[model samples]
Target: MIRLGGGPLERIVAVGAHCDDLAIGAGGTLLTACRARPGLRVDALVLSGGGGEREQEERAALAAFCPDAELRLTVLKLPDGRVPAYWEEAKTAVEELRGRTEPDLVLAPRTEDAHQDHRCLARLMPSAFRDHLLLGYEIVKWDGDLGRPTAYQPLSPGIAEEKVRLLQEHYPSQRHRPWYDREAFLGLARIRGIECHARYAEAFHVTKLTLNLGD
Candidate 1:
């Protein structure tokens, strides 16, 4: 398998349609990235679950995921599962974020995600950040929307384990949900890791990327 590396990333913006979406989809990658680049600037945005306990949960969760990095997170008050209804609001928020930071990477929900909110926010990405690398992250769901991700971020054994631990530790409210368990999280990572020839990994779908061969 060929390897593609993103060299010396300074800033990353992670957007999600709902609370826990970023952690579920790209938590391991964030952990790995933060460890690799101390003081890496991370700007996170969530479209829903704001002004509630979920928002507090997300803020703490991201801090754990992106340990020691310059993390700035914004949780919007848009209603959950109704992102498309608030298209203008979501678009404006995304565009405003883009205006503030020109990031090297963006971790977001894939356009083909089964959830309407996820897809709604995903569609807004390309229009907002035209020149950046946005790796569309995946969240395995009851809808069976997990598709073949075009990109992979291989995770180490320790990092993969920590991702699961942090998830279980931070989101107490999600614990009652049947799918929110260690096996489910590990099971998906194990599968994605197989695809990338690693013990564990986080997978992503990327619609566009500019490969630079010249230094």
Candidate 2:
């Protein structure tokens, strides 16, 4: 198990390929962090949907979720479902974001995710935030790509239910999808919770981590 140094984490960056990925994946962890450390600065970056109603919805949702933290939401203009084609551009965007904000913690998608966009973004995250703590989040899809996760953050049942409710309320566009129901959210969290011996939980994969086994 990877251990972290005990200290205050002030700056946090959550990067995702889509709008709701961060909230669905690591929202509880983010909320726990912010609540534990007041005045924490949390920035979210989405590589696409910079314009139109999607951007507006995301902004409102983030504001509601992270009211106490500073939010810097950047939705790039890159076309959706085509991020892999524009690998260089995606990398450049992530690098630029990294240059702007040096966060203490960075949450992103797991490379083993099913979606190509999520996987591509996961591969690009390491290039920018090499020194910070990185948590790779999982997204459930038809591919069933969820693998064995080494790290888990338990979420309260209320928070897990709230996450699904908020996603449904905020992102109306994605509601029509077959997998966008509360059952899917709770099912995934329940499975992860079983892995971690919690009521509800979110799982992640870590590439490199330092352990501090001190008293």
Candidate 3:
């Protein structure tokens, strides 16, 4: 298990292929991190969805979720479902972000995810943030491809509800999806919570982890 002492986190970067992916995957963890550090700066870097009305929706959604955070939200112009084709460009973008901010932690999508874009991003994350602590979050889709997750970040029931509420409120385009509902949110949380022995929690898969067992 990775344990952190009582000091605050100065910077955090959340990377995702789409606008709502970060929120859906790691929204609770983000909320918990922000609450732990009042002045913490959290950046949401979306590889796409920066054009047209999607940009506006993402901006509003981030503002609501991270009111106090110094937001550095960017939606790359790269085409959706084609991130793997632009592998070099995506690496450059992530490297540029790494150059700008040396975050204490980096949150990214898990490598085992069924989505091609998510898996691509997960594959690229280690190259960009080699020295930083990486947390890989999950998103439930129709494929039912959720795998064994080793990390758990517990969330309050209220925060869990707020996550779903915010996702629904921010992305009007996603409301039509049949899987996007309260049960999906709570059911996933409930399952993860059971793993962590908490009321609610989010699970993550870490490809590599170092334990400082010394006291």
Candidate 4:
């Protein structure tokens, strides 16, 4: 595999339509990056589940996922599964985030996600974050909406296991769901790892990226 390097990885922005979306989609990548660069700045925005149990779980989960990093999170009170109805609020929130930081990378849901909430947020990202590197992360569900990813973040055996452990430990509210098991999480990671020739990995869809190929 040909490895490519980018500019300094000091800051990143992670946006999700729901409370647990970021953790489920890009937890391992967050873990790997934060560990390597202590005090990395991570700004996270979750569109729904604020001031409730889900928000509580998300705060704790992200704190654990992003160890030793400067993490700032905002959880809105938008109704779940109704993001499109509150389109203006979502767009304003994303624009506000854009005004706050110039992130080296942005992790968000895939534009083609089966879930309406995810798709709505994905579509709004580009409007605010023009000229930024936007990576669309995936979440596996019964809808079977997984698609080919253009980028991969390889995780070590320990980091991969740690990601699972953190998810299981912090998000007890999600445990009742049928798909929230160790095997399911690890199974997806394992498959993505195979694609990138790693023991474990998290995949991402890139709609646009500007390569710095030695000018």
- Compared with the true structure, what per-residue lDDT tens digits does model 1 show for residues 62-153? 99999989999999999988899999999999999999899989999999999999999999999999998999999988999888889999
lDDT to native, each model: 0.94, 0.84, 0.85, 0.94
Query: Regarding TM-score, does 2 or 3 come out ahead?
Result: 3
Winner by lDDT between candidate 4 and candidate 3: 4
Inter-residue clash pairs, candidate 3: none
TM-score of 3: 0.94
Q: Which candidate do you rate higher for TM-score, 3 or 4? A: 4
lDDT of model number 3? 0.85
lDDT per residue as tens, model 4, 1-215: 76876678999999999988999899999999999999999999999999999999999999999999999999999999999999999999999999999999899999999999999999999989998889999999999999999999999999889988988998888899999999998999999999999989999998987887766
lDDT for residue 41 in candidate 4, whole number 0-100:
96
Per-residue alpha-carbon lDDT of candidate 2 for residues 4-116, written as tens digits (9 for 90 to 100): 45356889888889888888888767766766777788878898887888888888877766758887788887888888998999999888889888888889999888798
Assess every candidate by TM-score.
0.98, 0.93, 0.94, 0.98
Q: Distance (Å) between predicted and true CA of 59, model 3?
A: 1.2
Cα RMSD for candidates in order: 0.8, 1.8, 1.7, 0.8
For model 3, give the 10-residue run with minimal summed lDDT.
1-10
Which regions of candidate 2 fall more than 4 Å away from where they truly are? 1-6
Candidate 3 ranges beyond 4 A from true positions:
1-7
Give per-residue lDDT, candidate 3, residue 215. Answer: 50
